[model samples]
Target chain A: MQLFRGLSGFSLTPTDAEGRVQADLLGRLLQRIQAAGVDSLGLLGSTGGYAYLALAERQRAVRAAVEAVGGQMPIIVGVGALRTDEALALARDARKAGADGLLLAPVSYTPLTQEEAFQHIAAVAEAGELPLCIYNNPGTTKFIFGEDLIARLALVPNIAAIKMPLPADGDFAGELARLRARTPDGFAIGYSGDWGAAEALLAGGDAWYSVVAGLLPVPALKLLRAAQAGDAAEVRRLDAAFQPLWHLFREFGSFRVMYVIAELLGLCQLEPPRPILPLAGEVRPRVEAALQGL
Target chain B: MQLFRGLSGFSLTPTDAEGRVQADLLGRLLQRIQAAGVDSLGLLGSTGGYAYLALAERQRAVRAAVEAVGGQMPIIVGVGALRTDEALALARDARKAGADGLLLAPVSYTPLTQEEAFQHIAAVAEAGELPLCIYNNPGTTKFIFGEDLIARLALVPNIAAIKMPLPADGDFAGELARLRARTPDGFAIGYSGDWGAAEALLAGGDAWYSVVAGLLPVPALKLLRAAQAGDAAEVRRLDAAFQPLWHLFREFGSFRVMYVIAELLGLCQLEPPRPILPLAGEVRPRVEAALQGL
Candidate 1:
C-alpha cells in the first residue's frame, strides 16, 4: 500500500474535561477533515497529543479514527514511544485496530544513536505487517535524522516514507534535493513544517503533513490543490492569506496555537493535554487576530 | 530535613537482562557510595535511568536504596514524569518508601510554559510532605528554568534546592552569581555538569550532583573535598587527572559512557535502558583508555 502522499491531515484527539479521549467527538472531526479532500487521515500525530496519552487511550483513538474514516482514506496512527518494546506493542495494536499504516518518531528521554534508532525502527516494522512513515521532528524528539541515517532506514522493509521538518536555516529547496538524492526509489519524502508547506510542495515534496488542515480543512486543501497543480501564483496567493496564522504558529508553537484555532473554529470543544495549556496573555490576542484574518 | 548539601552521589538502577530492576545489586552499589563518604544519595537520577523505568521499578529501586543506606545518609528519589498526576503518585510513593526528599524535573513530551511548570511542581510538592529539589537539565528535560521562573518556583513551599547543569558556554561563575542574587535565602543551588563541578564548587555552589560519585566515589569525593577546602591546586590536579574520562563524556555523552565505565568496573552488569545503548566500536577503546588512566 502507498502509506501516504499528497495532503495528509493530522486529527486532534479531542478529550473530555477530565482528560479522557472523546472518541465520538474525534470521529466527527475525522469525518470533517476527510470531507475536505485530504488524501489520508493521520490520527495521533504530534498534533493529536499521542505522546501525552496513555496506551489504552491511544488504542481507543485509533479504533475511533478507523471507524470514522471507514476505509474512505488511509488512517495512519502514531505509534512512537520511549522504548522499543512499548513501540512494538503499539505498532501491533495499531495494526489490529485497523490502521492502514504506522507513523513513528524516535520518542526518547535520552539521546539515541543512529544504530540504536535503526534497530528500534526495524523491530517495530517487524512487529506488524503495516507500512511505516518515519516522523522526524527534532524539536520534539531531540534526535535529528541525517541523510545517511534516512537512507539507511529506507532500506528496511515496511519503512515506507519520511515526514521531515523544514530546515531551520530556511534552505528548504537544498534540503529537499539532498533527501531526494539520498533516499531510494519507492520511498516517499514529505515535509511537515506548516509554515513552509507551500515552498516544500513547490519543491516537489510528496506530501504536506499539515496541522491547519485538521482544523480548517477547506483552506488547507485549497493551498495543497494549488501547489499540486503547479500554480505557483495561486499557491503564493493562498500562502499570503495564511501568513497571519503562520506568524502565530511561529511565535507560539504550532501545537499550542493549533488548539486555540480549532477551538475558535468550533471544530472541537476539548483543551490540549496538561503541561501544554492554550495560548494566553500577549500571544492570545495575536492568535485571535490571526483567526479573524483567516 | 536539609535534603542535600555538599556531595550527592547519583546511584545507578541496575537491571537484569529481562530489564527487571535488580534491587539487591542496586542496594550493594548504594552501600559502596555511602561508604565513600557522600553527603547524600540520589536514586533514580538521570544516571539512574529514571525516565526509562516504570513507576513500580523506580519505587523498588528507592526501597532498596533506603534499606541499604539504613539512615546512614539521606536518599533523594527522582519523581519526575510527563503528567502531573503521575509525578504526584511517584512523589507520594517515594515518601512512603522512606525517601528523604523528592527530585523533580519538568519531564514533558509537549513543551511546558512557566506557569504550567510552576503549577505541576506546586501540585507535586503539595501531594507529599518531603522537601523537593528542582532538577534543571535542559539537555534532557529541554526546558531551562530561567531566573524569573526559578525565583517564582523557589517561592513555592517545600521547593528546596536546584540541581542545575553548568552553562554550556562554561560560564559557571557568572550563572551561579546570577542565580544567587535572584533566588531567596536558604534555597540551596547545586551543579550537575561533572566536568565543570570544580569551578561550580569554587563559585560557592551548595552541592555537586556527581554521576561519577556513584561508581568511583573515592576520587569524586576527593575532588569535592579539595574544592571544599579551598585547595585550588589539589582541585585542579584532580580535575586534570579526570580529564580523559571527561573527554569520553564529551564525545559519547555522560550517560552512555558512565554505563560502560560502571560495567567495566563490575559495579553493575546491566546496560542502559532501550534507545540508550552502551558504548562500543571506536569509542570503546577511548573509554577504556580513559578508565585505565583513572
Candidate 2:
C-alpha cells in the first residue's frame, strides 16, 4: 500500500480533563487535515496522546476519526501499548472501527530486549491484518530498533513501513540506502521529527510522518512537495520559514508545543494529559511568535 | 517514618496468562519475605510488574498484600502511573486498601520535565496522605531526577524519602550527603540495584529496596544485617555469594531473573506478563547454578 509513502499529517485527539475523547473536536481536526489534502491522517499517535488514553477512549477516537474523514484519506491509526495483547486488541478495535492502516510502536515499561521487541512487533503485525508501520521512536519509547531487527521486521507479513527518528548523525541518505538494501521492494521508510523531515524527504526517504502538520498542514506539505520534486533550494526556503516553529518544538517538546499551536491557530485549546504539563504561560508568547510566517 | 529506612523486599506478582493476580501464590511469596523479617514490604514496585497491571488488578494486589502482611510490617505500595490523576487515584486506592506508605516513580511516555515531575510527586503526596517515597528510577522510568528536583521534592509535605538508582560515579557517600543536607532530618534515602545494595548500605544508605529479597529473603536479610552492623568483611562475603546472581541480573534484567528464581525455589512458576517473555530455556540452568550456596 502507498499509505505510508507521503505527507502523513498527524492530528490530536482532543479529550476532556478526564480523558474521554472529545469526538466532535477530534472530527474537526481530522476534517482540517483532510481539507489540506495531506496524503494520510495519523490518529491516536504520540501527538494524539495515545499512551495517556485508555483502550475505550482510543477506540472512541478511532471511530470518531473514521466517521469524520474515513474515505477522504487513508486513516492510519497508532496501536501501540506496553502490553502486546493490549496492542493487538487496539489493532482489532481500529480495524473494526474502519481504520485503513496501522502503526505499532514498541512501547514498553521494562526496557525490552531486541528479541522481545521483535516478537511483540511480529505478533501485532500478524494480528493487525492491516498494513503496519514500525514506529521507531526511540525518544519516547526508549527501544532502539537495531538494523538487524528492522530488516527482520520488514519481512514479516503485514509489516509495511517504518517511521524513523532523525538520524543522530544526520546521515539520512546513508541510513535510507542501508535500510532499502535490506528491506524488500515497496517497503516504505518514513521519518517523523518535524525538523528533519525535509532532509529525510530530500534524501529520497518515502514519507514524512509529521507532528506540526497535525496543526499546520499547508506549510509542511509545501516542504514535502518541494523535496519530492528534488528541488533542494525550494525545500530549504520553505524549511527556513519553519525554523522558528521547529525551535519551539525542540525547546518545549513537539507534544507540548503542539497544544499551544492548536490553541493559537484557534482550532481547540486542550492541555496534554497530565504528568506532561502544558507549556508555561511565558512560552505562549514564544509560540505565538514562532507562527509568524506560516 | 521508620518504614522508609530499612530492608524493603519487593516481590514478584504471580499473575496468570490474563494478568489476573494469583492471590494465594502472591501471599505465599509475601510470607517468605515477612518470615525472614524484612523491615517493610514493597508491594507492586517495578519488580512486581506494577506497570503491566490495570488499576483494578493493582488494587487486588494491594488488598491481597495487606491481608497477607498488613499488621506485620509497613506496606509501601507503588502508585506510579503514566497520568498524574491515575497515580493519585492509585495512591487513594492503596491507602483505602490498607497501605502504610507510598512509593511513586515518575512513569512517563512523554519523558517528563523536572517541573512536571515535581508537581506530579507533590500532588500524589498530598492526595496519598501516607508518607511517600520518591522513586528516582531513571533507568526504568527515564525521568532523571536532578539533584535540584529531588531536593525540592524532599521539602514537600508528606514526602518521606527517596529510592535512588546507583550513581554513575558510585559515590553513594557524596550523593547521600548532598541529599541529606538538603532534605529534612529524617528524609530517608534508599538504593535499589541489588548488586550495589551491600555497598550502598555499607556506605550508610538508609535502606536496600531489593528484588532478590523477594525470593531469597534469608540470604538477602543476612547481607542487609551485615551492612547495617558495619561488618565490612561479612558484607563482602555475603555479597560475594550473591555475585553469580548479580551477574545474571546485569546480563538479563533483574525483573526477568526474578521469575526463574521463583520457579527454582518451588514457588509458583509464572511467566512475566508478555511482551516480556520468560528467560530462554537454556538460561534456566544458569539460574539454577546462580541459586547455589544462597
Candidate 3:
C-alpha cells in the first residue's frame, strides 16, 4: 500500500564510451540516486531508458538497475509496446529482472477502445505477479484514457498505482478528486504533473515521476520530503531552483530533453538512438546556464 | 503493373452468431463484390473492418477473402501494425494467403520521423515479392506522408502504388503532383477518396476504393464505367442517384453510414463489432429512406 512516496527519478539509458549498455555506469547511477536518497527509482520508463532499447537491451537496463539498487530502493519499470503479447512479455521479463513493479502504458500505434485498454491492463497484470502501475502518457500514445477506463483498471488486482501525465491546466485537482473517490487510499497516485510537481505534491499526491530527480536528486528529494512534512516554504524554495529544468522539458521534446540536461551537468553522457532527434544545440547553453544559475 | 484499376469495394468484416470471424459470411461478401463486377477487392483495411483485430483474425479475414474471390479478382490486403517485424510478418503471411498485393499504412501509435516511415515501407517491400501499395490514411494514423517521404518511397522496389485517402479539401493535390513528378507514368496511383471517386478517377487515378460499391455496386460500377468511357451524361446521371450515399459518407460517419447501407441492401447482415457503435437507431430509417429515394 502506497509503495512509492517520494521523488521517483525516471532513470536514463546508461551507455559506455562505445555507446552500449554500460552495466558499470548504470550501477554507478543507481548508487548516486540511492546517495541522494530518493524514495524510489523508475527504470526503463519514458524518461528512463525504455523505448530507446531493444527488448534485450531493455532487459539489461532493468536487471542492472535492480542489482545495483540491491533493495536500497524500489524500482518501477516501464512496459510499453504495440502488441499485447509483447507488452505482456516485457512485464514478465521485468518481474524476472526483480523489478518491484511495472508501469504499464497502452501499446503504441493502434488506438484502443476502453474495453481494449482494460483488457490490455488485465493481460499485463496476469502476466506477472508484481504490482502494476498504469502509465497515462496520451501525448506519446495519441490515445487519451478517460476517467471511466481508469476506474475500471483500478479493479484489477495487481494494479497498485497510476502514474498519469497531468494536463497543464487541470492537473491535480480534477484528477485527484475523481481518482481519490474511486480508487482506495492504498493505491499509489503519482502526479507526473512534470513542472507542477511542488504545487501538486502540496495539493496531495503519493509520489511524482520527476526528470529533475535524475540529475539533481538531492534537491528533488528535499522538495518532496518538505512537501510530505507540509513545509511549503521549503517546497517553494526547491521548486524555484528546479523550475528551470522543468521548463527545459517543456521547451524541447520529451525523450531527449533529460539526456541533454544530463550531459550538461556531467551526471551522464549518452545519446538517444536514431529517429529521436537531439535537443536543439541552442538549448544546451541555456541548460548549462540554468544549472549554474541554480 | 496496374493491379487494381477502376472502382474497388473495401469489404466489411463478417461475424458469426457468436460474434467471431464468420468466414462463410465474408466469403459471401467477397463473392458478391466480385459478382457485382467491381474492379478490385480491398480486404482487411480500415473500411473492410475495425482497426484493432488480432493477428490471427486479420489473417483469417484475408484468407476468407482470398478463398471467396478464388482468383476471380485482385484482392489487396492492408497490412498495418506498429512494429516493423510484425508488419513484415503480416506482409509475408498475406503473400502466402494468396493476396494479389499489399497496401501498407504507416505503423500506428508512435510519432514517426520521415526516415522511420521510409524504413517501414522499405522493410515491408523487402519482406515479400508481392507488389506493395503504401496506404496513406493520415486521418486514422495521425501520420501525413510528406512529399519527401513519398518521393523516397517511390524509389522503393516492389512498391507498385499509393492508396491515398484524399482529404475533403484538395490537400492531397500537392502531394499527388509531387508524386507524379517523381514516379514514372505507368505506376498505379489510387485514392481511398470515398466521396470523390468520380472526381478522382477523372483526375487521372488508375483506381479508387469504394465503400459505396459494397451496397450499390451496380450504381457505383455504372458511374465508374461511364467515367472511363468519358460519357459525362451517364456519369452525371449515376452520380446524381449515388450522391445521397456519397453525401451520407461525407456528412456523417462513413463507416457507420456504409455499414447501415450494406445492411439495408442485404449485402452483409452482421453489424460492426462493439466500440465502433452503429449509427443512431433513428438515423437508420433516414438512411433507409435516402437509399430508397436514391
Candidate 4:
C-alpha cells in the first residue's frame, strides 16, 4: 500500500440562490487544488466542501473534483452521518462518483466506543470496497480515537491512511507519538494543522493538508516539496511567506475563514451557506490585505 | 404571543425491529406524555424520535405525536438541518403534521450568522405559522445563541420561547440573567441539563425538558412541578429520588444511556441506533440497579 504524500485539502462549493449546487465554482476550486500541485485531492471534507452538502450535491462535488484533476490525482471523499446506514449510503455515493478513496469521520451526534469505531470502519470498508483514510478531528467528532482504537483499525482491511488534525494546543504530543507508533506499516499518516503543518511534517508526518494550497498552490506545493526534501531552512522560508494568510485564517475560524480568504483571493467567489456567520465589514478587506501580503 | 410553560421535551417514537417506527409504542409515548401532564410536546426534534428514523419515519413520528395528543397538549417540533431548504421543508412538514409550534436550531453544515439565524427562524415561522421556541443547544448546533442573537431573534414572527441550555461549565449565570432580561413579555426560557436540571430549574428556568421524563414521567414531572412551585424542600426530596438515575446518565454518556435505561425499565424496549455506542458491559448493570432504585 502506498502512503498519501504532500499537500491535500478540500475546497467547498458555495450554494446558489435557489439552494442548488454551485457546480461551476466547485469545478474552479478543483482546478485551484490541482494548480496547487496537491499530491491528492480531498473532496467532501469539512474544510468547506462536505459538511452540509446533500447526497446529490456531494456527488457533484466529488465528480467535479475528479474531473478537474482529470484523473491525474486521486480524490479522497468524506462520507459521514449520525446513522451508519446513512454513512453506508454516502459511501455508495462516493464510489459512484468515481472517487479514488474514502475519508470517514464519525458523526458527533452519537459517541462511539473504540471497538465500535473499529466496527464502523470495517462495515464501511465492506460496503464500499474502497480504500479509506480515517479522518480523526476530535473537536468536530467529540470522540477521540485512542491508541487502542487506532491499533484495532490498523488491522482492518483497506484502510489506506489516517488524516489526523491534532488540536493546535494541549498535550497532544503523546497522542501523536502513540498514533505514529500504532499506525500499521501499510497505512500512511497525514497531518492537518493551520499553524503546525511544518512542525507536524518535521515530527514525522507523511503529508500536510493545506488550506492555503486551495488559493495559492505553487507556494504551498513548494513548501510541501521542501518539507519532503528535509530542507528545514527552505520549509521555514515558505512557512514565513504563507504566515500572513495563516494569521488571517487563525484570526477568524479555521473552516469558515478559509472560505472567506479563498473568495477574497479570487480563487473562487461565493458566499458560505447560511449558519456560518459571515466575516464582518472590515474582515474581508483584512483578508484581502493578508492575501496580498502572501 | 405567550411564554412556553410546562414540559417542552421531545415526544419520541419507539422504534421496532428492522429499525422501523413502532406506531404503537409511539402512540403509547404520546399518551404517557399527556398522562404525565406535560404542558407541551416536542415531536420529531433530535430526541423526539426522528434522529435515527428515515424521512418517512420522521413524518410518521410527527403525525403519531399529533394524533395521540389529539389537540389536548401543545406540540413544538424540532426542525433543524445542515441545509436551509431542508429545515424549511421540515418546518412545513411540522405544520402539515398539526404541530402547535416549531423549534429551530441552526445546523452547522450551513453555519448561520446572527442575521441568517433571524432569516432561518423567520422562514420557518412563516412556513409553519405556529409559535416557535428557538432551541439553543450549542452542543448540537455548533453555534452559540448569545443574548444579542437571541435579542434579534425575539423580533421574528411567532417566536414564543427560548429553550437555552447552559454552555459548558462556564459561569453562565450572568448571561442567563441577561437573556431573561432581554426576552419580550410573551417569550419564555426553559432549560435542558441531564444532571444540572434541578439546579438549572432553580435558577429562574420556567420549565425544563428531560430525557428521563420519557420513561419516569411521574417522578420527573413531580420534581419539576416542585421546583416550579419554589418549594425548595420538595425539590430536594424529588431530586434526591431521581438523583441516582441522573448521576448514572452524567457518569456515563448522554442519550445512549437514556435509551438503555429506558429499555431496562421496559419503558421503550429498543436499542440505540448504530453509531451511538451502547453502555459498557459493567456500566449497564449499574444503570439497571439505578433504575431499580428509582
Judging by TM-score against the true structure, name the best candidate: 2
| Least accurate 10 contiguous residues by lDDT in model 3 chain B | B269-278
TM-score of chain B of each: 0.96, 0.99, 0.92, 0.90
Question: For model 4, how does the per-residue alpha-carbon lDDT over A45-158 read when each residue is reduced to its tens digit?
Answer: 777546666667777767666666757777777887767777788888778877888888876554467767777787887787788888887756666887677777877888
Q: Is the docking of candidate 3 incorrect, acceptable, medium or high quality?
A: incorrect
Candidate 2 chain B, poorest ten consecutive residues by summed lDDT: B1-10
* Candidate 2 residue-wise lDDT, A123-198, digit = tens: 9988889999999998899998999999999999999999999999999999999999999999999999999988
lDDT values for all models: 0.85, 0.92, 0.75, 0.71
Model 1: how far residue A278 lies from native, Å: 2.4
Give the residue spans of candidate 1 off by over 4 A. Answer: A17-19, A281-289, A292-294, B281-289
Off by over 4 Å in 3: A3-136, A144-190, A193-207, A210-223, A226-294, B15-20, B171-175, B214-216, B230-252, B256-275, B278-280
Best by the DockQ measure: 2
Model 4 residue runs over 4 Å out of place are A1-3, A22-25, A67-70, A111-115, A166-176, A257-268, A277-281, B1-3, B16-20, B53-56, B109-127, B166-176, B265-268, B280-285
lDDT of 1 by residue, B188-242 (tens): 9999978889898888889999988888889989999999899999998998889
Model 1 error, position A242 (Å): 1.7
- The per-model DockQ list reads 0.63, 0.85, 0.16, 0.45
Scored on chain A only, each candidate's TM-score is 0.95, 0.99, 0.93, 0.91
